[model samples]
Target: MSDFLVSRRFYAFAVAVLLLGAAWTIQSRVPLSDAAGGQLTSPREGFPAPEFTLEDFQGAPLASSSLRGQVVVINVWTSWCGPCRAEMPALERVYIAEKSRGLVVLGVNSTIQDNETDARGLARELGITFPLLLDRDGAVTSRYRVRALPTTFIVDRRGIIRSVMIGGPLAEAALRSKINALLAEP
Candidate 1:
């Protein structure tokens, strides 16, 4: 009877392990491209980006309309996202490097579970100097139909969204190329 019980328990444990493994594999193997609304391919091109006014990390209103007529790189991200934080310093570098050249890097902080105070602290710690727009209710996120973190929208000089780049902290070459494209726009 003892041997039978032990064998039954062992079999159950093995089955559980396999099931968990299968679940993880399914999740990890599913590409981000397969997400709802599919991959965002610059469809926003030649279309004006949705304007929003939200509290910044400093508690000031950061309005999208305020950025009218400037080339802007709008990055939708959150503090909790590992890839978001990892890629920010690079974005900051680009911001400082390009601001004098008339490029604005606006970070839209989306779906923060924590309160504003804690979120502000995290932003400061990240050394992000650009405007951080709060999206506590994810209204702006939804307007943009953002499905993933580290998503980027490039706005042209006329305030039109020229391109959209999604998933991960983009490679330096890829980022520079996109930025250059924005810079070239009239």
Candidate 2:
């Protein structure tokens, strides 16, 4: 074989390997959003999170601005999302673990499907004591562009999104780290 041809083939192979590795790394990190409306299904890592006024489980209007000067964990989730189900226990643990740090973990329920009772019941069964709001018109979900289940946004005391967790099968350590970072900020 000609030396030039061998070198060219070697370079092509190296490029292919690099591209494959990058793709795998990215795919490993991303999860699809199961959104009701056609919107952004993933939580962006560094964007001003979409804000909304949703009612608490008690039906009290909970405004986003109300969380100013407090660390709020905004979780966009659906009862039917498997990853959502898997991550709840860890989230509850984090909420209990950090509530005293001015943390308010609010789970925004998605209504892409026809049923509400089942989702509500599942949340209840999970012993999710935090504020869970219903996005019946899906207006709130559309605003956030949540296309997947269990997308979590961590808002700092300044009401800015410090970080986002997507496709959560998160460990307690992971949740704690993000919460701790937000807590550390002024």
Top model by TM-score, which number?
2
Error of 1 at 129 (Å): 0.6
Residue-level lDDT of model 1, residues 80-109, one tens digit each, is 778888788888888888888788988888
Alpha-carbon TM-score of each model against the true structure: 0.71, 0.72
Best by lDDT: 1
| Model 2 RMSD vs true structure | 9.7
Q: Pairing residues by index, what is the TM-score of model 2? A: 0.72
Off by over 4 Å in 1: 1-43, 112-118
What's the lDDT of the predicted structure labeled candidate 2?
0.77
Q: After superposition, how far is residue 177 of candidate 2 from its true place, in Å?
A: 1.0
